[model samples]
Target: MPNKHPYTTLISAANLLPNAQLENWVIIDCRHDLSAPEAGRAAYDAGHIPGARFAHLDHDLSGTKQAAAGGFKGRHPLPEQDALIATLRHLGINDDTQVVAYDAHGGMYAARLWWLLRSIGHASIAVLDGGLAAWEALGQTLSTEAPTSAEGNICAKPTLVASVDADDVLKNLTNPQRTLVDARAPDRFRGENETIDPVGGHIPGAKNRFFKDNLQADGRFKPGHQLHEEFSNIISASQTAVMQCGSGVTACHNLLALEIAGLHGAALYPGSWSEWCADAGRPVATGA
Candidate 1:
């Protein structure tokens, strides 16, 4: 059978080194800036972990943006399954491949890939703990050359994660069964920072969690017990959790943190705020 110890959530730089050369392992560099979209590819061209291929956040990970009923789909919508499968295949990922994704900014971008993989039911994926900084700090060498592999034969399987759309989120405002956790910075959540999306504030009842809280000063994730304790304070026993951010990107970071915290079954609000605020009719709430 496939590798016995496939990392499904987070893997450290040290543990990754020994298995870096394995044929079954595929590393992807998912470094991207939301403002300067091209910056990620440029950084990849400079140097990346050996055998790591680049997956652009916009082109590879997300779906096309088009008009929806009330307004537009979010900036980064989920990709069509066939398109995602094709991208994975082109990147040499097989069904059994142990995929590891990393980026410079903690695991924000990398976590997107990790969640996408799980959405396709490929559970053998993980984020590089502390990301590229951790790898470099370990005195590991980087490679400028690219690697090639035969196309992957992977296909979509049943989704391992859950996702809610704008309609579901709208309904939640009234029914409020699921707990909506906003992963944006407090300023943004408060509608004070409108630099990213056109509208500020958040969905009516979203609890501000700020994705960065999951990280330590060194950029690594906090210990599992600590994460569990912190998340427990926000999410109680009765509510199902739903994670969201600007365009469903950094929200994955929170989802990863939840998984690390031993809290499972949290769903993603894929369109998130960008989609939620697109329509003027949708209710918005500002302030803490």
Candidate 2:
């Protein structure tokens, strides 16, 4: 069983200011540019929240990709369990540590880290509400000085956190009780302007939510009640919802939004479109 922690889903920069100096708290800068790849570290080096550590999506979070045998495991496969345990401990996260992750692109990348922690059964994590922009807006200081702390003794207690594999997704297509929500943009979901994946279009019966819908104009998440209202129409509190995106990254934003909305039990399809499309026999759907 995964360990449980009493942590809120979102934490404001203002609320985090006082706790920033605590020894048991960890702030991770999850900023990343999917295109540039190295841009996240460069930006972190320039300036990041005080006492924040950098987490690279591809290097720190994902596992190695062996796309040799035509059985590639998607672009960003989950990191090996032991490797993830080492990375978390290196980041100074222990059982009681309060983790706050932030990113420039809304909470897209940061939510991935948040989801990973929760999947490991460590719920003492939250996404910095409104992200780094929210912190900057409050005039919080950014530190070029890398904060160092002794390595932590946190251990991984992995749990199967409501995720479905490609085969399960295929089986769910005919199951009316389940709903597949794609977090990609409308264009990408419709297979109109796809440039990343070799094949375009979404799963046969998937609906597009475009993760950004959960955010306001300022890039912060919408209020809880508002979020609940927006999602209630698509997924009920009791329904089983599966989230997915180009390569299992942005889909986490949807999962975060669902949690914020108090609509729980949504699972992640980590293999997502990247792995689903890898098999030529899988069905694809396009257009409005």
Candidate 3:
């Protein structure tokens, strides 16, 4: 059985002032461009939130090689456990630090870190409510100086991590206690779009609940009750759930939505369909 992680909710920009930051709070800047891998880091070096360390989606957060699955598909994959621990150490995270992550667009990238931290059994972490965009809108200060990583007693409790393998997914085909959600756009899920992946389809048993459906026109998460209703419409609450997307990035968006909906207790398919498709033997479903 995988250990359940403890996560904190509702962290705002004001909660991350310099005084609070020094009290052992870790901040990570997660930014990236699908087509422009170097842009995110270059932007970080130019300027970033004071004391903020960069977490690149392509390099730091994900694996170097993308499998043949339709998801990551040669784009990005989750890093190995040892590599993940080392990266976190490089960012200077300790057991007591209140880790906050943000990105330029929204919490799309930041949520990946949030889910990863929880997977490792540490959840004293939260995604910036509105991310860097919202933080700047609130008149928070910025800086060009990068922060140094602190050496601390942050250890990875491997037992606490929860993961779903290819076999696990196959077994869950008829398991009433499991639900798989695809977090791509409706067009992508329906195979009407093939711009990113070589094959345009989804896992056979997966349902379509585009991640954008979880948000309102304001670019913020919908009310808890509404989100609950949305999830219930596709999958049961009493069952365990897993989310996936193109290469596992946008899947973080759906996981974040589930969190915001207070539907807690779900896992992510870090490899997503990309990994699944890479095998060619795995089943796929395309078209509406």
Distance from true location, Cα of 38 in model 3, Å: 1.5
- Span of 10 residues, lowest total lDDT, candidate 2: 1-10
lDDT of each: 0.92, 0.87, 0.74
Best by TM-score: 1
Candidate 1's TM-score: 0.97
Which candidate comes out best when scored by lDDT? 1
Q: Which segments of candidate 2 are over 4 A away from where they belong?
A: 1-6, 67-70, 158-160, 237-239
Per-residue CA lDDT of model 3 for 172-215, tens digit only, reads 87664578888988888887767887778888878888877876
Against the hidden true structure, what lDDT does model 3 obtain? 0.74
1 against 3, candidate with superior TM-score:
1
C-alpha RMSD of candidate 3: 4.1
Q: What is the lDDT of residue 23 in candidate 2?
A: 79
Where does candidate 3 stray beyond 4 Å?
A: 1-7, 18-20, 66-74, 158-161, 174-177
Evaluate residue 132 in candidate 1 and report its C-alpha lDDT on the 0 to 100 scale: 95
Q: lDDT: which is higher, 2 or 3?
A: 2
